[model samples]
Target chain A: MISLTRASRWYGQVIGINDVTCTIQAGLTALLGPNGAGKSTFMKLVTGQLRPTTGDVRVFNQRPFANTHVFRRIGYCPEIEALYDDMTGRSFVTMLAAMAGIARAKRAERVDEVLGMVSMSHAADRRIGGYSKGMRQRIKIAQALVHDPEIIILDEPLNGLDPVGRKEMTALFLRLATENRCVLVSSHILYEVEQMTRQIILMDRGRLRAMGDVYQIRALIDAHPHRVSITTSRARDLARRLLEFPYILSATLDSADARQVTIETRSPDAFYDDLPRIVLADGYRVEELDSPDNNLEAVFRYLVKG
Target chain B: MVDLYLLRNALRDLASAKRLVVAAILIMGPAFIALAIRLGMGSQFDGVLTYGTLAALLVFGFVLPILAVVFGTGAVSQELEQRTMVYLLTRPVPRWRILLAKYVAAWIVISATGLLAALALAAVTYQPTPGSGRTALNRRSIVNPRKFLAQLQTPDSPVVDYVTQRLSAETLEQLSRWDPDTPAPRPLLRMVLTDLNKLIAADRRLYDPADFPEINVPDDARQLMAERPRGAANARLNRWLLEAAFPDLIRTNRTTGNKLYRDVLVLPVGAAAYGAFFLLLATILPRALITGLFLAFGWESWVPMMPGNFRLLSVMTYLRALAPHARPQTASTDMMQIFQALSPDTVPSALAWIVLAATTMAALALALAIFSYREYVPRDDAT
Candidate 1:
């Protein structure tokens, strides 16, 4: 739904987004990065707020800058918490709906529907200035969704949300994706992004580091050592047996608890497959097995650090 | 449709802003001062008119422009400062529409406030008293030629020769028919005398008999020879002087009042142009308020005092060009003389409005273009 070709944006001497190229399709895709990692810059570029200093950015095969037709199809929720404090949430959303070319007769209905989707209908009559942080975030999301655009781009939508609000928002994003809408949400929060979708575009220092499903990204970096912990009473025995596997780089008994063992493996898949077999053959009691590098955090760490 | 929506939103926001209250207060300051001066000093309608003109210069010229800067510069800058500009910019509406809508919103507020103040000042300062003969006469006569002539005479016996040389044949015949012994003057003579008096008074020194040596006489005669007789010719000459002066008086009063009226009418237009100018400045300069203040108060006020067409750069010149020509007496007033350098020729009302309209359109267009092309990054609000 959105594409960038060698797109770069520079703010005088400061680089906002470098010469990075990527395409995003319809789905709930998380843009993962650390602070100042050009995630917001990428969002702005795709949303057509900032033109790339070089190359091009296109949405639906059209340049989005001042393109009203393309803009009608795209909804952007900026990261800044700037809102008209004097206006009620409903009015704010309705105003945006009107600007989006929603029929005047239907704007109220559209505003209500979007506000309900974000679970902000109950407090929609209240001025945004008096709203809680989570409520403000919800209202911001409501405005972005008010027009029912094909592409919805949110930057740090989960920044000020409570845990329940986050859960609701994640579900809303999932629902949007299910509706065939392209949802690209940018965030530095790993767990929230993981909860939303495995499809992600990771960035760092104004450069795209990796893009794809979290596991696929993780799999690509399997050459990096993986750390696994085994909470078993027979720590020394497990450690000694683990050394027998050629894929296991090293193993050691936990310092605080002799019952626990930690192992580094060059191949985590081979280590897991051999673990149950050895336990069954030796009749050894296996309490628990946990791979710390199994999730997106480990994947992000590897990609960003490497 | 989008422009309408944006304009509606901008107007709503302006109505809710606390700064608008301050702007209204600033706009009314001149009216209040005029009221105070009118009531405290028991001044006449003419005094009120003069006060209104002075108010236009100080209030509309200086204060209203500052108000425009305050409202206009903040129209966009406030949104950017608060980081709320994204909401407006991200909408499907065209960028120019957003800018134009905002500019119109600010202009409406400023113009409405300024015009209200102007109307109030005009109403307060123009309370005509009921049928006072002296006031009527004051309005009818351009100059009291009798009083002017008396002021010009000294203890010199040559006054009759001077009067004979200056007066026209017709006026002299009329004067002679009433009292030929007093050396009657005609219309041309009266005009020459008036012109000479103007030249002599231009320097504002006392009239000296030494200036005219051809009409030699004794120094004991402190008054004109014509004053010694109470004759029909004297009365006829006085009647002729009135005839000569009335049309000019009526013309001066009408033209001056019309000019004042025009200035009042164009205050709103000037306010809108200033607002747009400030808004344009705000787009590229971070310290737009400082620049607006410097331009409105420092540059606009000071530049018009400068000689040559260089004053054309100031917006005040255009506004002053809409003012009426100053009457000689009023022009000679101490306060009016202080601002004499700043006064401009009275352009036609239509031409003045056109200049104001063109200025406003140009400023708004520049502001719209700047906003459309520029990329705005969210800045720290605390800074």
Candidate 2:
């Protein structure tokens, strides 16, 4: 497990990661935060690349910096564009494996396995300079796994991948987590993190504002009234049908158009699951349905305010 | 044996820098040969190109310092810049082993290539022919009036003779065609001495069967005389010329003898000087500035003579003092003036280099330590 206790890091006059104390359990934990929210800095601290100005960050109960023994269990994917462009992917990964003290006989096999895992097997013979951004990201992931690390912490691993690559990576993360190892992945995109793992730790301006599964964060957002809008040919019929529902506290006709209706609901999940059925039963033709205030952004806005 | 691994890696990269390796060989080899040929042709047709000018040309001017800078830093800087060092340091190897391995590999390659170039230069310039041989042949002979007289009017000599009645009418008539501002030729006494040297070929039929094959040339004779027993009379008129012309050349040969024990053994005391400069630059300059400085001064300033502003002048003097073995001092003011001018600025240059080397090793150590502590997975955005 990885734990940060009152951990804070400051650079001369600027705060990097502020007073973050949290336990990351064994599983796929998505570290979700916007840019400059201290996600990468926090990852660096946990991985021993940067030291905290105050407090403590420990992985397996040891200081990460200069602690070679702890590295046997942890893997870190840094957020820098640093690589040996001259080295072929296979040779580079093999070298890394050997450095990790893998037996000479197993080194080549381990390198090839990791290359295959990241779908870089065919291009493993080529120098990393020839790789595209997505290919490079895959090779990076391959290196991290060459030693078969117990905990893999990837800092923004999906930044340059297309949708197909993202899906493949998301699947790869799920597979890695299923190996009964801890996987901590950080990203600024809420939707991206959400697709990878339900377990999340959220931050704002270097402070940890929330931590839990997606449902728990959704509950925090649910406590506030969620705005729901509906557009239909018979909008009046849908608005009148929805007025009796107690969960939706208020309703208003949109000013610019008579064909749309907006409702304020305390429980958006209930409104969403039931609205379609009611509309269908009432014989109303719903042209559009949207919950404008039901995403992680609204959740972050609410929690940051609180 | 990660030391072995480090050595292997360093050697691989150095071997792979094809253009640089070729450039080194091409520049040093031909330059040495050309210098030897020039020296061989100019009065001392000696086969050996062991000129102080040549040594200065190869070491300070072109080869020695460049090798040190290129191999010394290139041995490890490429890994650091590429961030490949992260892979090595993160492994279970000791930091000192890494340094030592790299040092050894760079030293071996630099020493080997440099010595080969020096030897090649020596072979091309050192003359072993009978007439143009390594010794001073002291027998006096009459010089042809016309040939000997022409030299006094040449660019190198300051003295001029304008007498018109001392020669045959044909000789005088030939001389009168010369410009008046130019000196009338005078016969220069060509003195020569002899010493042991290898002979690869000889043509007995070329000269008079009764005459000695050894030719008398003052500069070559003086050089041969310096290595002879003290009781021998120097046959050359220009002992001062020989002394002035050959110190830097002799130092290159002298320094190679010192290489078996020292770390940077390119020039006699020059490795220490250049290394000191590089160490200082590495220390005070930022990462970007280091590359800029190396490209600017390192490549552009391939001068044969040592610059006046070089750092480590004192250390070079100390090295010069401590070289081979201590000897009684010779008090030639001209030599002293040259040495004094070449001496580096002691306080700042020495202190700066010491700090620079120390700090570079320290920074490298810290980087290694940091790398060892974690496994680096490539970042998504970094791609």
* Per-candidate local distance difference test: 0.71, 0.57
Worst 10 residues of 2 chain A by lDDT: A214-223
TM-score of chain A of each: 0.90, 0.86
What is the fnat of model 1 with respect to the true interface contacts? 0.55
**Complex DockQ, candidate 1:** 0.46
Residue-level lDDT of model 1, residues A1-306, one tens digit each, is 899999988877777778889998999999999988898888887877788899899999998877788889988898888799889999899889989989989888878889889998899999999999889999999988888989999999998998998999999999999898999999998988889998999999888899988866776775678888988877898899889888888898888988889999777778778888988898778788777776778988899998
Question: Which candidate gets the maximum DockQ versus the true structure?
Answer: 1
List the pairs of residues colliding in candidate 1.
B166-B189, B167-B189, B168-B189, B171-B185, B171-B186, B172-B184, B172-B185, B172-B186, B178-B233
The parts of candidate 2 lying over 4 Å away from their true place are A12-15, A221-294, A300-306, B1-3, B11-53, B60-62, B75-105, B129-285, B288-336, B340-383
Model 1 whole-model lDDT (C-alpha atoms): 0.71
Candidate 1 positional error at A234, Å: 4.7
